[model samples]
Target chain A: MSNVIEVKNLTKSYKEIKALNDLSFEVTEGEILGLLGPNGSGKSTTINCILSLLKYDEGSITVFGKDMKPDSYDIKAKLGVVFQDVAVFDELTVYENIDYFCGLYIKDKATRKKYVEEAIDLVSLSEFKKFYPKKLSGGLLRRLNIACGIAHKPKLIFLDEPTVAVDPQSRNSILEGIMKLRDMGATIVYTTHYMEEVEMICDRVIIIDKGHVLASGTTDELKRLAKIDEKIIVEANSFDSKYIEEIKSFKAVHSADYKERVLTVSYKEGADNLVKIIEYLKKNHIKYSRVYSERPTLNDVFLELTGKELRD
Target chain B: MFVHNFKYSLKALFRNKTLIFWTLMFPIILGTFFKMAFSNVTSSEAFKAINFAVVEDDNFKNDEVFVTVIKELSDEDGDNRIFDTTYVENEDEAKELLVDGKIDGYLVMPDKKDDTPGVTFINNGINQTIIKNVVEEIALNEKIGNEIGETIVKDEMAKGNFNIDIDGIYEKVMEKMSDETNLLDKSANKLDYSMIEFYTLIAMTCIYGGMLSIASINNSLANISQKGKRVSVAPTRKLVTVLSSLLASYVIQLVGLALLFVYTIFALNIDYGDNIAKVILLGAVGSLAGLAMGLFVGTVFKAGENAKTGILIAITMFFCNFAGMFGITMKYITDTKMPWLTKINPVGLITDGLYALYYYNTTDRFSADIINLIILTLVLTAVSFFSIRRRRYDSI
Candidate 1:
């Protein structure tokens, strides 16, 4: 696949603080490129700089094989952006808001109408098409905001935390809609702090922190960067600290902690780690209500790379 | 793109209830209150017949021209019944009537050959001034008539014609003089001082249009609103968006002005003079100045929408107060004391323009006001354009 967007040595500053520093990445054609970072980690800033919405101190950005500038209308025409904040007119209804934003790029009335309807359907806002923005709920308003941004069906779309405060159902619906967009053969740059969202939808992931790209790969590949290969949790009525020390003594055990009657153990690398822990629990006569083991998530990898939680 | 932006802009502004109230309904409500407050004032301030008495002595009776003039003026059936006169037999009787406050003053006929007619009043006021001015005018006209009659008589005698009808010539001269004075009085009566309140009301309405433009323009600035960021990211030119938004605002402003004119004219019985077209023209241009000012405030201020709105209100009210929206005396004081302020104030220019159209015979002052308003509009528009033409910002 060819690159739809290219960034090299992107640097931005706000007075004394650097918002982006020597950041470089490429968005391949027809794929979902997740920009994952914690709060204040320059995710939105990077997207803005790529879209030419912000002036960078030093770097070059290209969208669709052309240098991006504020007046790059041809590139801008094929780009759609859903900002973090809902940006729809309070005076307009859901349908009208979508139509208005779409009208900016699509001049044909018939085409705009069709596209606006399709957007409403994609966001599942067909029942509330006539409702004004103020009358919609938070999730519905977020859906409307998304519809307004992508109504024109651009070749490249930028979605910045579209489900920040949304409920699970709405978040699932939004994620599904984004996947459909990606399936429609359009390139998408999705930015979020939620690692699950990036893991579920993004074909490729770029983890950034402190204005620098920490790691970039598929979710499984990035997960390998974690120091531990597996994590185990056991809920028990009573757990002894001595057993946690014994679990720590295991050759594959990286770390073990017991807090609030829950024992969590990290394994460096091993197969049947859960079976081994279960056997040890049975032999020790420790009555555990639950025991489970899971592979390292992107958060673990981010924690390993940044020395802090991804949510931090 | 322009049409699309303009269409949605109109819808957005029209649906904004706060903007509708401030720009359209607020002005109408204020204008109604003004009409209610000034209704009695206008009626009370209208010209009324002066009450006075004349001491009917031999000289008063013998002065046929003066007696005829006074009788014609005091005639209730005449069109120019300027005086409600009661003749007294002697000076003492006239003095009693004046002291009784039944008459504004009493006119005494020339007591001696070298004496002239004089008016006496207990207190000096508008009525007293009117009586004094009328008496003095009659005296001046009589003197001029006498001179003219004498000149004609002398010229006729010089030409060796002794059959000169002096009485006929004097009567004709007096008749002509009275006719001209009556015409001047009629023209002077057309000056409606209370109309200043209405003129200022119109000016206030025009300036209030700035509120609409401020609200509209604020929606198009990326730093000020979320919608602005969406618009800025679009492929369309910023100038088209800004201009289309302003055009929508301008149209709404004109609609508000039209409603005001209609309500004031038909409902409040306010007369904006015969030049209704010029009044509408001045109102339109003044609204343009208002829109330009709003654009300037929206683009130049880094404050939020509410803060910018408050600033615009302060500006509009300042200009309105200086132009005498609150009271006409302020307008008079400002015009005389700070003529330069009036020249620079857009509201003052609009008010003065309407004043000129209502009161003046020529359009010189009105034309000057319109030109000044246009210049102000252009300057504000240029500055606002410069302020908003930037495609990118340091921060948003």
Candidate 2:
């Protein structure tokens, strides 16, 4: 297997907090992997471990089939990172800044120049080439940051919350740019709280909670694993508890509840499930004002697995 | 690694205009201040004139030649005068002048008592300075005349004709006197090598250069050192990043010093003499020492920017200022009364060496200074290497 990054039983802790507990994962060549986790669920910690930025209590990590040390320049040269916080030189103009960081990996002046221009074009920062970070707006700065990071054209890229706090337009542009990078053969390790972003871009997703991997698979596959398949809510002026018992008799009806003048029904999928619920409600003469249904989402899965209490 | 690190570092440093201002232009501004202070005329107008009261007998006061010299000596000029000279009618008048605070001195040319001449100077809580000095010097001149007369007479008697060799005896006496003095005087004017004073100044340059190095390195480390931790996941090594930052700092120091030297040498009319090349070379070494110091601080301090900037500044100031190495070896040049500090300051060593070359052209003070500077650079370099290598980006 051509693995760009690999981790085996990696455990990392800070003080008393076990940030990563026996975490093991790997990224295959040219695959964009989404690392999904709630805050303090050790998403960043795992990335740090994979990058060898943090020393784990157990397990080992290898990048490009070599033992990584702090001074692993060869590995570092092929790696590009855009941190959650914008990291770009404020003093340098956009072009100069890109050239400077790009020059580190590519020695040839002509090649460096070409890569820099390409990066500028990629991020659509050509017009702001001469502007410093201060001169650019928040969105422009974020784009410039991406350009600086990817201009070096590292084989592997780690983007942590790249779209956080950006305007929707810039965020959309950034996401497109990231997809283009993946299309161009750059493997990406992305982390974010936004589920749609993962679903939209990630080839596969890894869901971690409390320093351990809760689930990992394609988004659809992960959704299939969730016990809570669907939810149904009926708002009404009045309802009887006896109707819940009758609704439970229907096929595939796992549970039914009638409380606070409204009857709520949740169940696994089955043929004619909605039709049976309506017939039961009608026979019982429960006047419903509103009704709604939703399939299992990543947010539901996260809320169920990690609990809704704030981590920090 | 070299160019990459240098480029990034340069980019980073230019972001801080405050640091650049203090490190680069401040010194030249200070030098300009000194230039203005030393070059402009120091008006004696600030000081009160010394009052002179001469109790001369009528014999000398009536003499035209003596009166002319007196007038020439105690003269007043445009808005400023050396002394307020008063002619007293008698000793009582002179005493009254002294009592009234009207005069600083009194000179009484008494009647000739000894075979020579006598000049009695009196003062009531006042000094008889100028006139007393003149009278005594006149007496000494007479004594010199007597000696020269005796010599001439003795030589004429010995020789059939009056011809004597002055050069031979004068040369011997001058040589003997020179030998008795300290060696500091040996190359006072010769630029054969760097002088001790020059070495002290070069050391001072290192001290000031260290300011930017420390500031930039610490600022980068504290703010984004963690960024390295994040970057470590890539194909890049932390050391390369560090080296690039250091290289950038070195370039900054070079630029700052070059600007200063250019302005000082060309614009401000500072003379580096034939030692221009030597100054540049020594300056490069000084820049290295400064960068080494910066790297050391950056690596050693893992806390926030406040702590880093504070500690770096403290270290730079302590080492540079304490050694009298930064500017003219302050103690050695101005003879500032800082005994212990000037002795051990390492920055002093580099600056003193360069200063000697640039100014006095004496090399005696240079060897020790160069040795000291080399040792300091090595020590700082070692510190930078060890600290940066061992320090983790997240370690506080």
Please give the interface root mean square deviation for model 2, in Å: 3.6
By DockQ thresholds, what CAPRI class is model 1?
medium
Off by over 4 Å in 2: A71-74, A232-291, B11-16, B33-205, B214-245, B262-285, B305-307, B316-362, B391-396
Indicate the residue-level lDDT of A25 in model 2.
Answer: 85
lDDT (Cα, tens digit) per residue for candidate 2, span B307-348: 655675676556555444343334333223553454345565
Error (Å) of candidate 1 at residue A132 is: 1.4
lDDT against the true structure, per candidate, is 0.85, 0.66
Q: Write the per-residue lDDT of candidate 1 for residues B282-382, one digit (tens) a residue.
A: 99999998898888888888898888888988988898888877766677567656989998899899988987777543466789999999989899889
Candidate that scores best on DockQ: 1
**Residue-by-residue lDDT tens digits, candidate 2, A1-312:** 399988788787788888889888888889889988888888877766565565678888898988766567788788887877776666778998788667767888899999999999999998989998899999998898788788988889988888888898998899999999999999999998888888889998888887888888888988887666676778887666666677778777667777886666767774556666677677767789887776877776767677778777
Q: A18-114 in candidate 1: lDDT tens per residue?
A: 9898999999999999998778888988987887777889989999999999899999999999999999999988888999999999999999999
* Off by more than 4 A, model 1: A237-246, A258-261, A279-287, A309-312, B40-194
